[model samples]
Target: MARLKTLGSRIKESAGSRVKVVSPGSWRSGMTSSQRGYGYKWQQARERYLRDNPLCVYCERNGRTTAARIVDHIVAHRGDMALFWDETNWQSLCKPCHDSVKQAEEAAGLGG
Candidate 1:
């Protein structure tokens, strides 16, 4: 009987470099979430915004009503606090749309 290779094992076999093990308290760009301005204030603002805009804008455009779970920045902040906190730059999106479409838009430099 042939055994199926695990995804991790297959990836490791195909990839040359070992996966970097991130230590606890280690964050990308050497800055924590709070340092990135996503602290208490942002949380409170996000909650308030979500309350006011309960539906996902993208989903709504597609004629599907979905509850928004993420308050996304229409423009990439890139450490700009002004842009980060700009209410006008905010949009409510469902997890799927935010993670997939929005991420792809940002990657393609179309977002913002």
Candidate 2:
């Protein structure tokens, strides 16, 4: 118990020690992925984006609303933080359109 308490104190002391320190990697001493809300933040972002772009992107282009239920990436926003915040790369698409785009891209060897 004493040792655990000491470790906790050390971590608390080092809270902001490294700006580059990122979770899903660190938290070595003793912490869980869920202890921090790393996954939740992204979920929130997705919900917000879906609410904002609540129409099938392709359907909208054709002057209709298929009630897009998929949030797609015009250019997939992999782990790139720069594009993470860019709404331009994200579009709402119906499942069919999204799957079609993904499939076509994969066939063309342009999938990411």
Q: What is the C-alpha lDDT of each candidate?
A: 0.88, 0.67
Residue 7, candidate 2: alpha-carbon lDDT: 42
* Model 2 regions more than 4 Å off: 1-38, 109-112
lDDT against true structure, model 2 = 0.67
Q: Which residue segments of model 1 deviate by more than 4 Å?
A: 1-28
TM-score of 1: 0.76
- Candidate whose lDDT is highest: 1
Reference-based lDDT, residue 8, model 1: 58
Global lDDT for candidate 1?
0.88
Tell me, what's the RMSD of every candidate? 6.7, 13.0
